[model samples]
Every structure is written in structure tokens, then in C-alpha cells.
Target: MINHILDHRYELLEHIGGGGMADVYRAHDQLLDRYVAVKILHSQFSNDEEFIEKFRGEAQGAAKLSHPNIVNIYDVGKENNNHYIIMEYVAGQTLKDLIQSAGKLSVSESLRIALEIAEALEHAHANNLVHCDIKPHNILVTPTGRIKVTDFGIARAVTSSTMTYSGTIVGSVHYFSPEQAKGGAISAKSDIYSLGVVLYEMLTGQLPFTGETPISIALKHLQEEPVSVRKLNPTIPLIVEAIVLKAMEKDPNNRFANSTEMIRDIKRAESGLLHGDRQNNAISNQDPFATQILPRVSDSLPSRKSNLAPDEKIPQTNLLKSKKFLWGLVCILILGFFAGAFLSYGKFWSNAEVIVPDVVGKQMTIAKQMLETKNLRVNIAETYDADVPAGEVVSQYPAAGTTVKEQRLVTVYISKGGEALEMPDVHGLTKVAAETKLKNMGLKLGKVEEEYSNEAAGTVLNQTPRSGTKITKGSAVDLVISKGPKSRKVTLPDFSGSTLNSIETQLKSLNLKAGTVTEVTSSKPAGTILDQTPAAGTDIAEGSSVDFSIAKTEKATDKNTNKNSGKDASKDTNKDTAKNSKPADAPKDTK
Candidate 1:
């Protein structure tokens, strides 16, 4: 597929990397004069229109995402039999390659990379998109140490293959969240869990879950706790380790509610403000032996009455009257004893316990009243939320139904509508960079308009909701990008002494095709290519035709005639010799 151009825009240059069902190629976008990475689906699935449309739809959703750390999608189209996606090409190795080469990175370096990835994830989650697959191979590390998280919505279309060599999918199983492994409901928390696995790998230079088979690894993701990062690498900070563990909690409810929460905790980890005891995933660190074991009562109910020997019974008395008199004296004694016991015990029995009520999503005032009436102090923490409306509680700590003593602090997060973000400066930046900027700010991409400018093509010239404009989450921003200076000419490549197949490849690469064929007389053997209309290495407009010819060898009749003449001459000589020597042989064929 090399040298093939799709949609007359992206020219396939070289194969880069890919998975079982796709191939990634480094290509040049002729219209924009920029290099792009083209990902084309495998032909095996081309006939399956349903799968193709699914992939296309996912690509469309991915195209809508824009974040500094995400590889920007430029276009998606189909040309002939090839269905492809054009993306911003970064000139760097994947995080997978880096980790493989370095074996392990320092704690600070790993944290920096992890934070960048988290920020990208936060933007995606805010847009209601989840990356089902998260691994080092999809994370690009640029020369400037910037992280670019790629393959956003495409992972949803990537079905798991049973083949073992499909390292692409199998390798990702190591980082799969428990729900993902079980094929359960996937959400933002799932991504956070995968990111936590990535963090663990970064800190320890090893996968948290691994096995000889993908199924085994998946099972580990579902049922096993990962080895501690700090235990593997002591240099990792306590808070950083805790953040990683907290995010990897197997239970979705136990994990971060969303990427926003994870990012918040990550930011605090950078300052070492998180405590070791706060790790939700630290349930793995707990020593089961240290837990107090309460003796469990047998499932058998207590016997209602003990077996009695009937023959031993003798006399029956006024048991009720005698018991009443004894109970009266005991009651008097208990009252006097309680009076003395209360005087000695200060306030052990004074505090009452109440079951915490579920107040999340309720109006802040109503929730406050509910908690106050329950004798629990309401501690309100205001924060922005896209899903929860303003004045409503977004979430609560020590979630409802937990029994706690009176006057206990119950923290509630009140929503303040969507978070306000300023439009970032994107002028002079590439279209991909601008899109990433918008996405990272929790904004969507609007119509992309192009204009001719002196600046290089693909560079952003203008943007709407102009830079620094404060906007709520999920807002749309339009962009005007340069189409590059008009260039009607293209450089022709050398095609000397090449076969028809090679010439055809060259023609496709140069966006030109053979127009006419003619016979040419030359010293070369027949069928050997001879010449072309326009000489190689000349500049011409794309689609301008170049004619070529093949050599014609000598006529076959002439060779046959020469051979017949020689044969006749030899036959005549043979006949004359036979006649001359007939007398010596005594007998010759008279006929």
C-alpha cells in the first residue's frame, strides 16, 4: 500500500506501526503541506459494512476531541478499497518504546508523564468519552517531553482477537480495569483504573498483571491486587503511590468518581499533600491476619428448650406469684444499682447514633436541613459539576446508611454548574495543536474553515470564542487555518530503468499515471521499458500525464528463414556425399 494516496490529500510515505486490524503509515498531506499519520482498516473487514460504519462513527467522535496531550484527528475518509483516518503525526517514539529501552524511569519523570496523561483523560471524560484501552503503546512522547495520548474512540471499535500474537490487544489486558475484564459496564472510573495500572508500570517498570495467556491476565485484572509500586521501587513518594492505588480500586464506587477527581488528587500528590492512609486501594495493603475475628454463631438456631426427663417432675407450685414477688425485689435492687452506676459513669450512654441519610443530588438547602435534623453537622464543599445542577449536592462522603455518632461531620460537595475555562491562545499553532488546546479546556471543535495565508498550511489563523473567552464546559469553538501558499506544481520522481510494476508504483506516489503506450525500436530486449513522454526529475502539476514505451525485438520469421536455409544446405551436402560413397557401400537406397 506504500505510495498510495487516499482522497488525493494524504500520500502514504512509510509504514509506521499498527494493530491486528489496521496499519498506520506516515504520510504527507499534499493540500495542507504537512505530514500526517494515516490509519487504514484491514481489508478483511472492508466487506462488513456494519463494522466499517461503526469504525467511521467512532473516528468521527474522536475527531471531535481536542487536547494538548491528544493526537488531533484531521480527517476520515475512504478511497477505493481503503478506509482511512488522517491524524497529526508526532515525531517521537511511543511510551512503550521508551519504557522498553529505559527499563524504568525515575519517579519524578514518571509522575510528570502520568500527570500529562491524566490531564488528557480528564478532558475526554468531561466530554463523556471513555478510552476502553489505555497502555503505553498508545501514548506518544514528543521530543520536548510532551505526552500525546492517542487512539481515543478507536479503542471501542477494536474487538479482542483470540489470536495470541495480537500483542496490541493482549498487551492491553494487563491494564484492563476489573469491569473491563468482566465485560461489564464501562465508564469514566474504568479509565481511571486503567490509568492507575499505567502509573504502576511507570513507577515499577513492570505490568501489574501478567500471564502466559490473555485470559489469565484478564482474570488477574478481575481478582488480583497488584504488587505495591513503592515496594518495587522505594523511591516513589508515599502520596504518589497512594494516588495510584486509590485510582486502581477494583470497585468503581471505591475508585475516583471521575477523571476530575483523579486529576485533583494527582495535583495534590505533586505537592506531597496526600497521605498514605487515604489510599482506597490500600485494602490490598491491609493484613487480613490483623483483622479482629469475631466468632460467628452457627447457622443452627438456639434450641427452644433443653431436653427434660419427664419422670423426674414431682410438684407444681404457684410459680407466677412467687416469680412476681422475686421480680419486684430484683427491680428495686436494679433501680438502686443504676442510680449508683450513672453517678460513676460520665456520658457513655448520652450520645445517640443515627444512620447517615443519602443526600446526594438533593438541593443543598434541603440536604443541609436533612443532615442537621439527623444531628449530623453538614460540611459543605462547593465545586463545579457538569452533570449535577448548581445548588444541588454533587456527592457526599461517608455515603448514606453508615452508622455514625451524633455531631459527626458529613462532608457534601455542592455543584456550581459547569467549570469556567478560558479559551487558550491557538493562533500561529498547528491545527492539531489548536484542537488539543480546545479539548483540554473541556470544549468541542466547531466547523473548521480554511484560508490561504503566507503562513504554512495547517496553522491556525483565527478562532471563534476568541482566546481568553470564558466559557462553560463542552462549548464549541470554530477555527480558521491556513491552507498554505498555493502551489500548483509538484516534484516528479526518478523512474529510470524500472519495470511496469515499479513505474506504476512511482506514478501513484507522484499522483501521476501513464497516459499512452507505444512501441519503440531499441537495442533492449522485447517487453523491456524504453522511454517516457516527460523526462524524469521534471516538475509538473499533479495529474499531468507521462507516456512511456517498450522495446520490440527482431521478427521471428527472419530467424526461422535463416535456420531453414542452413538445414537445406546441409541436406544437399549429405545427399551428394551419400551418392559419391555408394559404390564403396555396395548398396544404397535406390528410391
Candidate 2:
């Protein structure tokens, strides 16, 4: 499994992490040449056709959703016996890990994470999808403090069915909504309840409810009210605690209606907590997205689904019971027709115009509501934006505060966030040159690895997200650069007890050199080699030099010894002659 390449594309590199359901591995996508996290469903569940189909459906739908706080799903497939999902490879620690290490987080920090999670939920809920599981384990926090939610729908399909089949609640008992605990129908509010549990854990460093067994803990969710987060962690703000308690209400109806409502209240809590506002309930602080009933059709003509023109003559009525009844029906239809015409004409002339409020920076949901509130129709056009969040309008045609007739179309260019771009060709460029190109294209250099290649030294031989591949801006491109041909090497050969000329020949044979030949007279034969540097069997660069020393031959040592002996003998002879002549005459003997 470690080296298995799924679909002949994703090369499994190493197992990184996983939860109870899947074994996650870090893989390299050969087609795109990028790092991806591949989550393969465990074999235990492979035979469950119901679970597999549900998992596949959920993955498909989740893949369609794009949010800053949600980990992106790239692909999902079944390769033979393996069911796998390739997703955004986020380099971060799990929120659970962070909580374990930090114990309890600060008030502001907790809200920040919770708010982001809520935003993500709102996005998914808007698409009519619920993230059944919302816990610290499924949440990831980047080093930069950016929060991302993962396992959006996979957990939902797995837990719901697995619980049914096994009659055992799994890992998420601590965060279970009471309704979920009861095996009742679940909705977005159920997720809100789970989020409350997550928030409670974040603030208190422990689950709000716990018991000896999963079922018991689940029962606590169904029957027990958690200790106020404030009680567990006194530092938690009153508003924050209230928000948590409201979300974790036993009845789903008792919780925030949806992600939007929860987000609204969470924002209020955050503001009150941050500013220390006296009015902790700031739900009505301001809503960017506000709307009113606006005509879906043009204001010029009264909106009517029927094809019948307002001026068209009334058709003969069907008589029921008597002629008097038919005549009465005729009169009623004529009068009603005239009344509708007059009312539409009068209302068109009398209806007031509301200024198109500034909703450029507001979320699309809020902006649409604001437009509808003004009796204006929103016409959206999507484009990429880097400075603004996705779903925010880049610009409005009628502009802010512009007076327009009711039902007027406000052409809003909404942002879908940064547009993905095709990676450019950077092969054959030097390391510095390639990096410069990537930076210019709003990309970053990922990993830089060197390998021996025929390509020029330091030139890029290949790049991940190969040229012309569409990828989001700021995506790192791993590169493979050539370190030129591998360095040439030669092994040192033993040259001990070998003549200088002979050793030089041997070094040449090995594509090496004899560095220096030192001759000295010793018991070891001269020119027969005493020792050689780089002792033997050592690998070094081809043509590298090896130093050597050789002992002098015994014959040469003997010749020098005899010369010294002869000189000493001559000195002794002179001394003897001088001594013998000294008795006769000291001056004559010295001469």
C-alpha cells in the first residue's frame, strides 16, 4: 500500500494521518505533479455497498463547494478495491492537537476559530448540505491561524449508516446533537449543535458531556444540559457562553435556525466580547445582506406567470347551476379585470424608489437581500478577485445609493476568489531564474531537489503542475533540477611495495595520479613503495591524486655507510701519527 500508485497517477508516498474511517496518505499526482492528500476508505467498509455509494455521492457534492475555510476535494474515485478521495494537502496541525497542547484557548482565539467554522458551514448549508460532524478533529488550523474544515460529507455518510449497522455510536459522541443521539432526523441545526460542543471544548479544554461509554455519552447529549461553558472556564464571556448554550440546546428548534443565524449571533458575541459592550446581544448590530420582497419580473409590466395579456378580453365563464350565476360570474370577471389593471397602473405610478445601498464589500447572500429589500433585482456575474472574499461583489452597476425603479437589475460582478492560472513553462531555466518566473506569475517555489541528469547543471529538468496546468495562485510548484552528469569517480588501488614507475603506471590505469614520490633509505626496499595515501579501495573523483612514500634500497644505504667509515678512519690515522711524533718535537709532529 505504501508504494501503490492509484489510477496510475497518484503515487502513494507515505502515510501521514487518518481518522477511524480512512487511512490518509501523502501522494504525488503524476498527471498534475502536485502533492495531494489521498484518503482511502478502509477495507472493512469496502464491502458495504450502501456506505460506498453514499460516500461517493457526498464526495461529488462536496467537491462542488468552494470556500476558504473548507479543504478542497480534487478528485474521488474507486481504483479496484480501494475507494479514495484526493484532497487539498493542507500543511497544518489538527485543532484537536492544538487544543491538547494549549489546553484551553483564549476567548478571542476560540471565537475566531468558531466564527470561521460557522462561515464554512453557512457556505455548505446554503447548498443544502450539512457537515454532520463538526469537532476539533475535523478542523485544521494553519500555522498562520487560518482554519480549514475537512471531511465535510464523508463523515456524515459514514457515521449515520455505520451507527445504524453496528448499533454503536463512534468517535463523535462528545459533539453529538441530541437529535443525532436520538437517531432522529438531522439538519443544519444539528451541525450548529455539534459546533457548540466544539466551542465548549475549545473554551474549557474538555468535552461538555462525557460518560464511561459512547452510548452513555450520547445519552447525555439527549438528556443532559452541559455545564455552562462559563462555569467550566470562568474567563469565557457571558455572551460567548450564551451562544454556546443556545447552539447546544436539546431540541434542534431551540438552537440557532441555521448557519446564518448562528453566524450572526456568533458575530455579535465576538463583538461584545472584544469591545466589552454592555449590550451582549448585538444580533441586530448591522446586517449587510438584507432584503425585501422584490418582483422577479420586470417592473414595466406587472409580473404574471400566465401568458394572457392584461388587455386581452375575458373568456366566457363556465355556467354552474343557473343563468343568473353565469351572469354574476361574467360581471365579477369584468370588474376584477378592470380592478387589476387600474391597481397595476396606479401602483406603478405611485410606488417609491429606494436607493441601491452599498453592498460591494458585503457577502452575496446579504447583498442579495439588501437588493431585494430595495425592490431591485440582482443580476450576478462572476469573476476572480484576489483582494476580496469569494461571494462578495466586486462592483455594482447601479452603484451605491443610486436611485432606481423597483425591480431594476443591478449588475453585480461577484468574486469567485482568485482565478486559477495555468502554470508556465520554467523548464531549462536556472534555479534562480525559475523562481523569478514563478514569483512573477503569482506562484511560489515548493520543493527544490537536484538529480544527476544530462541537462545542463543547475537547470530545471521538470516542474510540478506541469506547464499549462490550471492551478490557483500561490500554489507551490515542486521542481526537479539537473545537477549535471554524476561526478566521475575512481577507486584507489593499493601500491605498497611497488616501484615509483610501476605505481605511476597503475594510477594511470585507474584514471588516477601518483602525487609525490619520497625516497628514503630504510629496511623497507627503496623504489619498492612503503605506503601510499588514500590507502586502497577508497572511491574518489576520477583523476584525483594519491600521495606515496618509498623506502631507499639497502645497497644505497650501505654505500653511504662505507663512505662515512672511510672518513673516520682517515681522522684516526692522523691522530695516531701526531701522537707518535709528539715525543720528538711537538711543532714537527703537528706539521
- How many pairs of residues collide in each model? 2, 10
Per-candidate TM vs. native?
A: 0.46, 0.48
Q: What's the TM for model 1? A: 0.46
Error of 2 at 501 (Å): 88
Model 1 spans > 4 angstroms off? 159-171, 273-591
Mind giving the per-residue lDDT tens digits that candidate 1 earns over 374-457?
Answer: 877766667777677766778997789988777677888877777777778889999888888778778888999998889999
- Total backbone collisions, model 1: 2
- Per-residue lDDT over 285-329 for candidate 2, one digit per residue giving the tens place of the 0 to 100 score: 344331112344566685444567768766677669679998899
Candidate 2 Cα misplacement greater than 4 A, ranges: 163-168, 279-591
The Cα local distance difference test for each model comes to: 0.77, 0.80
Most accurate candidate by lDDT: 2
RMSD of 2: 27.8
